[model samples]
Target: MSSAPVVVVATFTAKPESVDTVRDACKTAIEAVHQEPGCDLYALHEADGTFVFVEQWADQDALKVHGTAPAVGALFGAIGDHLAAPPDIKFLQRVVAGDPAKGQLRA
Candidate 1:
C-alpha cells in the first residue's frame, strides 16, 4: 500500500452575524497553514454562513505545525465567540481518484 498523510476536512456553521468574521478568520488560518513546510493544500469555502476547511498535509508533523501556528491561534481566539457550535472535523484516506464515473482503488 502507498503511504501518504491523511486529509483533514472540517465544516463549521457560523452565526448569521458572524459569518463574515468567521470567513476572514478562516482565510487567515488557511494562509498560515499554506506556508507551512509540508502543507499540500489549505483552502476554505463558505456558503450561507457555513464554512468548510479542506487541508492536505505531508504528514502528521506538518499537521501538528499547522495546529500550533500563531495565525491559527489568532483565528481561534477571534472566532470562538462567533461560532454556533464547535467545528466538525474529519480525517480521511483517499480510496479512489481519477474519475467519479469509474471506480478506482487506492493501494
Candidate 2:
C-alpha cells in the first residue's frame, strides 16, 4: 500500500425532504472524524441538496481504518435512508501546479 498522504473527495446527495437530517448527521460525523489519528482534514460543504466532504489522511493505512470507524458506521446509520444513493467517494493524488502554498491540501 502507498504510504503517501492522500486526499478524499466524497459527495452525497440527499433526498429533497431529508437535507437537514443529512447535513446534521454529516456534521456530527465530521466532528468525530477530526479526532481520528492521521486525519489532517475532514470538512463538509453543502449546496442545493448535495453534500461534499474534502478529507486528508496521513497515509493509506489510516484511510483504511477510517473506513470502518465507528463514526462512519454511525453516520451511515443516521443518514442512509435520507441519501439519494450510496455516497460517491474518490481518492485523489495531488499534482504540483501553481503556487506551492495554495495549490494543495495542507495541514
Candidate 3:
C-alpha cells in the first residue's frame, strides 16, 4: 500500500462563548472526512478553546477532495463567526513512518 503523502496541521482559536459550537463543527467535519476513501486519519484536539485539526491523506488529490467536501465547507463557514482569527494550516510530507528515531527521512 502507498504511504500517506500529505498531512495537514491546522490551528484555530475559538471565540470564548462559541468554543463548544466550533469544536462540534470540527468534530463533524473530521467524522465526515474519516469516512472518505483516501483519508487515513482525521483527528481533532482542543486546549483552552483552541482547536487543532490533524489529518493524513493518501495524496494531494485526496486532500483536495476533503477541502471541497460539503461538510468541510460548512464547518469553515460556521467557524468564521466563532473564530478568534483565521485558521492556520500547514501541509507536511511524511519523511518517517515508524519511531521517530528509527524511521528514515525521505530526502
What value does the lDDT take at residue 84 in candidate 1?
92
- List clash counts for every candidate, in order: 0, 0, 0
Pairwise lDDT winner, candidates 1 and 3: 3
Give the CA lDDT, 0 to 100, for residue 15 in model 2. 98
- Number of the predicted model whose TM-score against the real structure is largest: 2
Candidates sorted by TM-score, descending order? 2, 3, 1
TM-score of 1: 0.82
Q: Report every candidate's CA lDDT.
A: 0.79, 0.94, 0.82
Worst 10 residues of 3 by lDDT: 98-107
Model 1, 1-107: lDDT tens digits are: 23376588888899989998998888877766777777887778888899988778777877777788888789889898999999888987767667856652221
Q: Where does candidate 2 clash, by residue pair? A: none
- Give residue 86's lDDT in candidate 1 (0 to 100): 94
Name the better of 1 and 3 by TM-score.
3
Model 3, stretches more than 4 Å misplaced? 1-4, 95-107
lDDT per residue, candidate 3, 1-107, as tens digits? 43546778999999999999998888878777778777877788899999987777877778888888888888999899999998999987656477876762221
Q: Model 2 off-target regions past 4 Å? A: none
